[model samples]
Target chain A: MALLNKDGSRLDGRGVTDLRPLKITAGVLNRAAGSCLIEWGRNKVLAAVYGPHEVFPKHLTNPRRALINARYIMAPFSSQEEHGRSGPNRRSIEISKVARHVFENVVFTERFPKTMIDVHMEVLQSDGGTRVSAITAASVALADAGIPMRDLVCGVSVGRVDGKLVVDLDKYEDNLGESDVPVVISPRTKELLLFQLDGLLSKKEVSEGLDMIFEAANVIREKQVQALADKFKDVDSGDLQ
Target chain B: MILEEIKEDYIKELLKQKKRIDGRALDAYREIKITKDFIQNAEGSAIAEVGGTKVLAGVKFDIMTPFADRPDEGVVMFGSEFSPIAHPDFNAGPPDENSIELARVVDRGIRSAESIDVKSLFLEEGKVLGVFVDLYILDHSGNLIDTAGLAAMSALKNTKIPKVEDGKIIRNEFTGKLKLVREVAVTTFEKIDGVIIADANSEEEVASEGRMSLSTSSDGFVCSAQKSGKAGFSKQELMDLIDLSSEKSKELLRHI
Candidate 1:
C-alpha cells in the first residue's frame, strides 16, 4: 500500500507507535487568565482560560459548583474543501464535549464556589486528533492561568490503520484509517478523564490502544510540567500575570 | 458602535484638531497589527488588526477543473462576511450591497495587482485550477475596506501551496510565500465641511453628504474607485481628492 513505505512503515518514517515532532507555546493569550498554543503534527489549536470569575447568562449558573463552558471553533477556511459555513458543526460539538470532560477531572471546582471558568479553544488548523490535542493543551493553559487543579491532565490519541496500530495519526492517515481511540488521562492518579473512539476496533485492539495512550499520556504530562517551569523559572509571580 | 450624542459631539470637537477618537489624526489610520500563518488547517491564513477592526483571511488552493472561459488561468473567488458578533447592526443571512462592495474592493486590489499568478493555478490545460481567496471579518470598528484588503493581501502573501508528486500529495507543516507582482493601495474619502477627508469612521459616515473610495498603485495607476451617496463632487474636487488619495495610498502601503 502507498500508505506504507517499502520497509512496511508509514510514509513519515515513524514506527507505528511513535508520534510526530511536537512544538508548543505557553501563555499565548494576553487577555486570558491562562492560554496555550500546541502544534501536534499539523493539528494546531489555541486554548484560552477565562475565569474563576463571574458567570454570565444567569440561568446556566451553578449555585454550588463552578461552571465550565468550553467552545471549540474551526475557522471557515481550515480545509482544502470549502466548509460552506463557519462555527460549531457536529464534529466541533463532539470535541467540545470531550474537552470539557477532560478538564473537569483536573480542575478543582469546589475551590471556587458559585463562580464559572470558561475555556475557549480555536482550531487554526487540523491534521488529525485535534480533540486530544486541544484537551491536552487546554489543561496546560488552565494551569498557566494559576487555577487550582488536582493533577495535570494529558491526552493522547491512538488508532489502527491498514492492519497496523498507530499513535497520533496525521490528517491523511486519520482520513483513511479504520479506527481511532482518543483518551485523556490524569497522570498522577491514573484516572480516566475522557475516552472516545471513532470507527470500529476489536476488544483486544481497544485494550491495546488504551494502554498505549495512557503510557504516552504520562510522558506528555511531564513535558507540560517542564514547559511551565521553564517559563516561570527565575521570574517573580507578578511576571506570570 | 453605539455612542451618546455627547460622544458624537466630542468626536467632532476632536476632528477640529484633525484628531480621531482613538488619538489618531483625521487622515491617519490606527495601528496595523498582523499575524501570519495563524491558522494551521488553512493553506494560507492571516489576521490583520486595524485599530479595533480585525479581519482574518485564509486562502485555500484546491485542484479542480478550470472554468470554460478561463481555461489557462486559476479561478479566484472572494467570500466576505460581516457577522453580527462583530458589529451590532450587521444582520445575518445573505450579504447586502455594503458587504458586496467590501468584497469587491479587496477583490480588485488583489486582482488588479496580479498578486496570484493565475497561470500557476492550472494543473492541466483547461483542467484543474489551484487558488481561492476566502476573506472573513471577525471584528468591525471602522474602515472595513482597508482592513479587508490588508487581511486578504497578507493572507495571500503568507500562503503556500502543497506539493503534488506522482498524484500523491504530501502535507508539509511549513508554508512558502505567494507571488505578488506589486502592491495596491485603498483609500476611503468623506466630505467634511465641503472638503474631502480620508478614511472616515461610522460617525463621520452618518454625518457626511456622501463618500467615495479610491484604490491605486505606487506608480499612480488607478485600480478601482467607487462613489456613494446622492451628492456629487465637482471636477476640480475629484482631481484634488485623487491627488490626496495618491499620497495617502503610498502611506497606506506602509501599513501592509
Candidate 2:
C-alpha cells in the first residue's frame, strides 16, 4: 500500500510523533478585557475577550447562565492562496462553534447571569491545529479578562501523515497530509469537550492520535499557566511606562 | 456625518481650555510606539502604533523589467486600503477617495524627501529593477498620514536586497542594511475651533472643519503638504506650523 512513505517519513522533516514549536502570549490587546496571541510554528492566532456584561439584545439573554458568542476571522492576505473574503467564512463558523463549546463548559457561566461574553479570534496564519490554538488562546484571554473558570482548556491536534501519527501539523503538512484529529480537553479535569477528525483515519489510528495529543496538551497547559504568571508576576505600578 | 455634531462640541472644548479627551495639549501628540522588522516573511516590515492607531507596512522585492521611459530608474508604487475587517464603516471594493488621497500624500512625502535611493534600485542600467516598496494599512484609528509615513520609512530602512544567483532567486545568507538617504516625518494638524492640534484621532478629525498634513525631512525642509479643511489658516499660522513640523521631524527621525 502507498499509505506509508517509501522511506517511512512524513512530508516535512518530522518524526513519527513530534509536535511543532508552540508559543503563547496573553494581554496583547489594549482595549479588550483579555487578549492573547498564540503562535504554533508558522501559524499565528489572536484571541480577545470582550464581555461578561449585560446582554445587548433581549432575545439572546439567558437568566440562568451567561451566553458565549464567538467568531473566527482570517486575514485576507494571510495565505498563499487568496483567502475568500475579508470576513468570516464557513470554516471559521465551524471553528467558532467548536471553540465556544470548549470554553462554555470550562468557564463559570452560572456566576454571571443575563450577560454575554464575546470571544473573537483572528488567525493571521494557518497551519493545522487552528481550532486547538483558538481554544488554548481563548482560555488565556478569558483569564486575562479576569473571568473565573474551572480550569484552563488545552487544545492540540494530532494527525496521521504517511501512515505515521504526528502532533501539531504545520500548514505545509496539514494541507498535504492525509488525516487529522483535534482534541480540546480540560487539563485539570481531564474532560474532553471537543473531538473532531478531518480527512480520514482508522479507528486504531484515532485512538493513538488522541493519546499523543492529550499527553502533549499537558505540557502546553503548563506553559499557558506559566505565561500568565510571568505576565503579572512582579510589575511595579510605574512599569506601565 | 453621524459624528459631526459630537466633533463640533469637542472642538469647542479644545478652544476653551486647549484640552482633548485624551488630555493632550493643543500642540502635543499622543504616545507613539514604533517597532521595526516585525514581519518575518517580507523583506522588511514595521508596525507603528500612534496612540490607538496602528499601521503595519511591509516591503517586498520582485525583479521586473524597467519601464520604457524610465529605463535608467526603478519604479516605486504605494497603496493604502482600510480593511472593512478593521472597522464597520470601511466598505468593500476598490479604495475610496480618502484612501487614495492618503496613499498619494504619503507617497509624495517619501518621493519629495528622496528617502529611497532610486538610482540604486536599478540592477542593470535600462534593464531590471532591484527593489519595490509595498505599503499596506492594517488598521485606521486616525491621522493615518503620520502613522503610514513612519511605517513606510521604517519598513524601507529595515529592507535588505535579495541575493540573485544565476538568474534564479536564491536566499540571501549574507546580511547587510539598506542605505537610507534622508529621514522624512509627517505631522498631521487638525484645525479645531480656529486652532491647530497635532496628530488628531478619529473623533478630533471629525470635529475639525479642516486638516493640514505636513511632511518634513531631517534637514529642516518641507517635503509635502496636504490641506483638506474648509476653513483656511492665516499666513502666520501656516508658517508656525511649518516650523513646528520641522522640529517634530528632527525629534522623530532621531528615534528611527
Candidate 3:
C-alpha cells in the first residue's frame, strides 16, 4: 500500500508536514516530586522526577555535578500483540543512557553536587514515537519538580513514508517507513540534545527530516510550557490545594 | 530494615480504634487503577496501581522446545524486578528474596488456577509456545505482591497470540487472543495489632505482624495462598482473612 497518495497526503489523512495530535498534562502523580503525562497520538507516556537527593551505591556519584538517572520503560500491555518484558532490556537501557545524556545538557546538574536527579519515563500506551515523546515528558517533569534548567527540551520524529518525507510517523507508518530521524533540542538555545537516524535515507532526505523535526520541537516546547502553567495556575492565584 | 518506633506505634494505636493511617477501614483497600495495552511492543501489557504502588506487567510469547515432562503443554514463566528507582530501599542487584517471593506468589496463583489454556499453545510434540510474563515494579508504596499479581493477570487476559507458520512467528499477524480458562485476582491483608487491614501502605506494612495473600478465581475457589512475616495467624483468623480476600477479589476482577 502507498504510504502517501499522489497529492502528498499521508495515510492518516495528514499532509507531509503535519504532526500528530499532542496532549501534555503536568503534576499528575502525588508520589513523585514532579510528574507529567504526555499523549501524542496513540502514545501515552508518564514522566516522574525524584531526587536531586543523595545518589545510592556511592561510587557512581560525581564530585563536581549531580547525576541524571533516566529510565524509559514500556509497559507490557502497551503494545498490540506481545507483552513487553518489565526490566531494563537492551532497548530500554540504551534509551535510558541516551535520555540521561539529553537531560544532563538541559538540567543544571552542577548545582546539586554529589546528588542525583532521577527521571522515570513509563510508556503506558505506545504507537511509535515513544522515545521522542518520553524525552518531551521527562523534561516537563523536571521542570515541574522546580529544577533549574538552561532551557526546556522538546523532541519529535520525522521519517520517510512511501518516498515522501513526513513528520511524526504513527505506528503503521513507522513499521513500513523507510527512514526515521528523531531529534531532541533545547527550544531556547536550539542546542541539539539527541539526534539519531535509522533505516535508509539520502542526504537531501536527512536534511528535510531534520528541518521538520526542528520546527516541530518548537511547537512541542510551547505545549510543554503550557502544561506546566496549567498545573501551577492555582498556585499563582494563591489557591493552594 | 529499621521501623521508626513512633510510626509503628502510631499505626498500632490507629488500628485499635478501627482507624487507619490513610483513613481507610480495616478491610478497605486503597484506590485501584488498571490500565491495559500500555506497551506497543508486547503482545499484552497492563499497569496496576494500588494507591501509590505501581506495577507493570508485559506478556511476550516465544517459540521454544517444551520441557521433557510437559511436552504437550505450553510453558508460562514469571519474572520480576524490583528496580532501585521504584523505592529507595530497593537496591540494584540480582533478584532478592522479596522479588522472588512476589514472583512465586503471582506465578502460583496463575498456575494453580490454570488461567491460561496451555494445551492449546502446543504447536507440535517438541515445539510449543512459551509465555513469558515479566512484572516491573515502578513505584513501591506497599503491597507489591498484590499489585504485581493483578497486573500479570490483566496482562495475560489482554494477550493476543500471534500467527505461527512452519515454526516461524508472524509479528504482524495475530491469530487470536490467548485462551483463558479463568480469571484470577489476588488480595493481600496485613495483621496490625490483631486487626486485619487490606492494602497496607509502607507505614502500615512495617507495623504489621503477619501478611497473607489470597488468590481467588472467578469460580469462587481459592487457588493459591501465601503467608509471611514474623507473626502467625490463627485458624479462625485465616478463615476470616480468606472470606475478606474472596470478597475483595470480586472487586479486583472487575478490572479484567
Candidate 4:
C-alpha cells in the first residue's frame, strides 16, 4: 500500500515535515543526580546521569579530564517483538557506543578531572527512532544534573518512504522505507554529533535528508529547553543561564 | 615547544605541519597487505594487514532454522574478538563496545552492499544457511575497523558455498563459488590539529579528536558510515570526507 494518502498526507495524517507528538519531563528519577523522561509518539525513554565521581579499575581514568560513559538498555518487554530479550546485544552495544560519543563531545569533561560521569538511557517502549529519543532525553538529564555543556543536543531520523522524503518516521514507515538516515546536531553550534546511513541512497538524497533533519531538530531543541526550564521553575531563570 | 606538551600534543604539532608522526601525507593510507587462505580449515579466510594492525577473518557456514520474523531470509553474522594478544588494552572477556562496534560496522558495509546472495542459501521453508564472518584481532596498532572490513570482504571473495545433499552437509566437496554482487571497503580518517589524516596508526589514533569511517561499495556509493570520538563535524566537512572516502575505497577494492 502507498504510505501517503491522495491528499499528500502521511499514513498518520501528518505533513511530510511534521514531527510526532513529543513530551519531555526532567528530574524523573529521585535517586540519580539527574534524570529525564521523554515520550515521543509511542516511544518512552528515560535517561539518568550519575557520578563525576571516582573511577573503577583505576586505569580507565584520565588524570586531566573526566571520562564520559553512556549506555543504552532496552527492557525485554519494551518492543513489539515476540518478547524481545533484555539486550545489550551487538545492536544495542553499537548504539550505546555512538550515544556515548555524542555526549562526550558536548560535556565539559575538563571541569571535573580524574572522574567518571555515567549517562544511562533505558528504553521503556520503542516504536521507532529510539536512539534519537534516548540521546535527546539524555541531554536534558545532563542539564538537570548541573553539568555544563556546550549546547543542548537534538536528533531526528529522516527517511525516504515511497520515494518521498519525510521527517521523523514511525515504525511502519521505518520498516518499508527505502532509506533511514539519523542525524544529530548540537543545536547551538550546528555541529553534527552523530551521523549514520542505512539505506541505498545517492549523495544528493542523503544531503537533502540532512537538511530535513536540521530543520526538525529545532523543534526537539525547543522542547528540551522548555523541559529544563519547567524543571527549574522554582529558582530564578538567571540561575539557568 | 609548550611546556605541557603531552604525547598527543607532539603528534598534533607534526600534523599542523602537514606531516604525520611517520611522515605520511594527510590523505595517504598505510600500506595494506592481504593474505588469502590464511586458514585452510575454514570455508574461506583472509588476513589483512594495514601498517602494524592485523585482522584475520574466517568464513564458516552452519544450517539453522530461520528467524521467526523473517523466515525466508538467510542470516549473515559478523563477530569480532579483540584478543588480549592484539594489544595490552584488550582483555579476555566477552565482546566490549569497541569490538561490537567494529563487527557491526563491517556487517553494515557488507549487508548494505548486498555482497552475498542470501536468498540462494535458502534450502527449505524453515531451514537456511548462515554465513558467519569471524574476525580476530591478532594485532591492534590502530584503525582496526578498516583492517577488519578489508579482511572480511577479501574472505568473502574467496568463499565457496558448500554443497548440500538432501539438506545434509558436504564439507569437503565443492558447490561452486559463492555469488558475490560487489566488493565493499572502508576508509577511516581521524581529525588531529583540525586536519583530517587517513589510516591513522596507534600514536595518531590516540592524538585524534574525532574519527569518521565511511564504507564504499564497488558500485560507487557509500554503503555505511560511522563518526566517533569526542568531536563533531560541520556538514561541509562531513561531505568532503565522504568524497574522500569514496575515492580511497576504489583503490582498496582494486586490491581485493
Candidate 5:
C-alpha cells in the first residue's frame, strides 16, 4: 500500500509534478449550445452549456444579471464504490454550488440580464479531482457556446502522499494522502476561483503546495487553450499562423 | 439574508474606514456563546450562537456496515437544516446548497482533524459505530459556518458512547467519553469592497463579494478550507487569510 516507490516516483510512475494523460475535446454534443469532453487521468467528464434563456419558476430571476446554474452529477456507475442513487447528493450539491460560483465570475452575466445559463457536468468516470476536472471542462464548454468571459478558468490540485509533495493526485493518492488542495484559477485575471482543502496540512505545506498547484495549473491551462484552438481549426477559422 | 434589508452601501462604507457596522475592528468576531449538552435525549448536544446566528448540534450513533474500502474505520456524517424560521431566504424543504455546504465544511474540519478515533469505534469485523451530527439553524444573522462548526465540535467533545449489550445499547448507560484526537474550528472571512473582514454579519454577508472559510485544528494546522462566491483572492490575499484563520482559530478553540 505504499503510495510511492523507493525512487520517489508515484505508484503509476509519474514524477512529483507530472499530470496524468490529459485529453480534452470540445463540441462533442450537437444539441447543447456548447459542449466538451475531458479525460484526465482516469476521470471521464462531459460538460454542456445551455440557455441564456428566460428563467423558469419566474421567481429565481436576477434583474441586474443573468443567473448561472451549474449542476455536477456523477453517474451511478461512475465510481468503484457501491452503486449510488443518481442526482444531486450532498457532495454533488456542494460541488455544484462552488462550480456555479466559478462561472459567475467567469461569465459576463450583466450583458444578458434577466436570463439564465445552464452548465451541466456529468461524470462518466471518476478517479479523483472530479470537481476540478468538471469545472475545467465546463469553462471550455462555456467558451464553445460563445458566452463572453472575463477569463478562462483552470483547475488543478496538489497533495501530500507518503510525506512527499505531488501534483495532480490520482484516486489512490487522494484517498490515502495526508492532504489535498484543489484549486480553480483564472489564468489571466490572477484570481483563485475555487479553493478547497481536505485533510490536515501545516502552514509551510500549504504555502509550498500552492506553488505546485499554480504551476500545474499553468500546464493544464495550456492544454485547455490547445483544445479550444483545435476546435477553432475544425471550424475552418482562417489561419495565418 | 433579506436582500431588501441588506445595507450594502453602509457596510462597504464602514469597512473602508476600518470600522464595522457592529463597531468591531477588522479582525474582530461577534460575541460567540456555546451551550453544551442541553438536550438530554441525545448522546451529545450543544447550541452555538454568534451574534444573532444560532445553531444547534446533536450527536447520535448507530451501528452500520463499514465501507468496503476502509472496514476498520467508523463513519461520521454531518447533516444540516436551514429552517424557514432561521432566515427569510431559507425554505422549508430538503436541504439546499447552502445548508449542505455548511454541513460539509464543518464535517471536513472534524473529519480531517480526526476528532473521533474512527478505528477505535470499530466494533467487529464488518460493523463500526457511525456518529451522526445534525446541525439545526434556529436563527440566521450570518456566519453560520463558524457557529455550526462550534456546535458540532462541542457536541462531539461531550458525547458519550453508549454501552452496548448483545449488540443493543442501554438507554442511559454509557461507557466513557468519546475520545477527540484534536479540536477543530472554522473561521470565515468575507471580502467586501476589497476589504477583508472576519465573521461578517448577515448584512455584510449580502454585501460581500467573496467568502472563504478556513478550518484549523487546535494544533495549529489548517484541517480544511472552502472558498465560495463569485469574486476571488490573489495569492497573497489567500496566504494572509490562511494565516489569519490560524490565529483566529486559537480564539475560537478557547470557547470550545
Candidate 6:
C-alpha cells in the first residue's frame, strides 16, 4: 500500500508536512480539577488532573517535594480492531512512567512537599500520535489545575512515510510507514521533555524530523493556549455580564 | 455526601414542578452525539455522548475454541473500565462491581436482543470467533449504564468480521461486516420525589431514590431491564417507564 500519493500527499490527502485536524477543549469534565479533551484526527484523548493532595502508600511519597503520578490509559474501545485489557498494562505502565518524568521537569514539585499531583490521560479513541496528544493535553490540564509549571509542554510526531519525512502520522501512516519520531518540548524554555524514535531513520532524517516536530509543536502550543483561554473566556466575561 | 443532601432537597423541590436542574423536562434527555469509527485500531469503535457523560465502545475479534455445548456458536464478551479521569471517585484498579454491572447490563441488552448472529462467526467445528466489546467511561456525569449500552451497540453495529486464513487471523484484512439481527437502545429512568426523569446528571443521580434501565430493540421489544437503588416503583410507574423508554429508544435508534 502506498503511504503517500504520487504528488507526495499522504493517503489522507494532506501534504507531507500537514497535520491532522486538531481541536482542543479544556475543562470538559466537571469532576476533575482540571480537564482537557483533544481531538486530533480520529484520536480522542481526555486528560484530567487531581491533587496537590496527600499521597497514599507512605513509602511512595517524597517528603521533600510533590510527586507526579501520571497515567496514560488506552480505552479498550479506543482502538479500531482490538479490545485492550483494562488497567495499566506494560505499555501503559511505561508511558505513565515516562509521562510522569516529563511532567516532573515542568511542574515545580518542590512547592508542595509530601503531596502528589495525579495526571490521568484517557484515550477514548486512538488513531496515532496519542502519546504526544496526551502529553499536550495533560500539560494544559496541569495548568488548568493551578499547578505552577516552568512552561506548557507542546508535542508532535514526525514520521518517514514512503521514504519522506511527514509532520504528523495518522494510524495508517504510523503503522504502515517506515519510521516515527514523537517529541515533546516546552515551548517557553525550548527544552525537550520527551523524545522517542521508532523504526529506521538516518541521522539527517532524525534532524529533519526534529525540526519539523518543533515547528509543529509551536502550532500545537498556540492551540493549547487558545483552548485554555476559551475555557476561561466564559468565566472572564461572566463578571462583566 | 452531605452536599448530596442539600442538592437532593433542591432536586426534589425542582421535581415538584416537573423541572430538572439542567432545565430538562421530566422525561427529557440531554443532547446525544454518536460518532462511529472513532478509533482506528479496533475493528469497530464509537463514542456516545449523552449530556456531559461520554462512553467509548470498541469491538475486537479473536479466534477461540467453541464451547463444548455450543460448537457452532461464536462468543460475545463485554467488559467495562471506569477510568479515574472520568470522575475523581473512580480509582485505577481492577473492575469494580459498578464496572461489572454496567458491562453485564450492556451485554444482556445485546445478547437478549440477538443483535449479532453468533452462529455465523463459527469457522469450523472446533474453531469459532470471539467478539469482545469493551466500554470505557471517559466522562461520568451520570447515567453511564444507558450511555455505555448505546455505545456498545453502536460499536458492534459498526464492526466488521476480520479475515481468517488457515486458522490465522489477518490483522489488516476484513472479510465483511458482521451480521447484525437487530438494533438495541437502552434508556435509563431515575425516580426522584416520586417523579421519573431521564438522563440525570451526577448531582441528580446522587439525589435519585431509585433507578431503572430498559433496553429496547428497534422493533419495540424490551430485551433487558435492570433496577437499582433502594427505592421501589409502583406497577403503574413501571409500565409508564417502559412506555417512556420504548418511545425514547426510537429517538436513540435513529442515531445508531
Score each candidate by Cα lDDT: 0.71, 0.73, 0.83, 0.87, 0.90, 0.82
Candidate 5 residue-wise lDDT, A27-114, digit = tens: 8998999999999999999999998999976898989999998999999999977797888789999999999999999899999999
Error of 1 at B226 (Å): 1.5
By summed lDDT, the worst window of 10 consecutive residues in model 6 chain B runs over: B227-236
**Per-residue C-alpha lDDT of model 1 across residues B87-171, encoded as one tens digit per residue:** 8778898766567667766676566656678886666764554666766878886778877787887777777777655443456
lDDT-best of 1 and 3: 3
Which residue pairs in candidate 6 have backbone atoms (N, alpha carbon, C) closer than 3 angstroms, thus clashing? Answer: A79-B42, A80-B41, A80-B42, A80-B43, A81-B41, A81-B42, A81-B43
iRMSD values, candidates in order:
28.6, 28.9, 25.4, 1.1, 0.8, 25.6
User: Which prediction has more favorable DockQ, 2 or 4?
Assistant: 4
Tens digits of per-residue lDDT for model 6, A1-241: 7887887777879987788899999999888999999999999999999999889777888878998888899998899877878886655765675577678778898999999999999999999999999999999999898899888898888888878999989887887777666777777755446654454344456556767877888789989999999888767666678
Can you write out model 1's per-residue Cα lDDT over A60-177, one digit (the tens) per residue? 6777778778787788766645663787755566467556656655678778877889999888887787777887788889999999888877778888778777888887777676
- Measured on C-alpha atoms, candidate 2 has an lDDT of 0.73
Tens digit of per-residue lDDT, candidate 3, span B14-68: 8889998889888888898999999978999999999999999999999999976
lDDT string for model 4 (B91-129, tens) is: 999998899889988888888888898888888999999
Residues B157-247 of candidate 5 have per-residue lDDT tens digits of 8999988777766767899989998998999999988899999988888898899999998888889999999988888898898889988
Give stretches of model 1 more than 4 Å off. Answer: A1-241, B1-23, B166-170, B173-176
User: Of models 2 and 5, which has the larger TM-score?
Assistant: 5
Worst lDDT 10-window in candidate 3 chain B? B227-236
TM-score of the candidate numbered 1? Answer: 0.48
Poorest 10 consecutive residues of model 4 chain A by lDDT?
A: A197-206
Docking class of 4: medium
The TM-score of candidate 2 is: 0.50
Per-residue accuracy of model 2 over B1-256 as CA lDDT, tens digit each: 3664466686677677877867887777777888988988778889887777888887776667787646876677787777776565788887665666677777777876777777776767555545655556666667888888888888888887766555544555424666788888888888777778888877778787666677777776566665553344443465677788887777666655
RMSD value for candidate 1 = 21.8
* Cα lDDT tens digits for candidate 6, B40-130: 8899999999999999999999999997757999988888999999997899998865787678778877887778899999998799999
DockQ of 4: 0.74
What ranking emerges by lDDT with the best candidate at the front?
5, 4, 3, 6, 2, 1
What candidate 6 gets wrong by more than 4 Å, as runs, is A1-241, B1-5
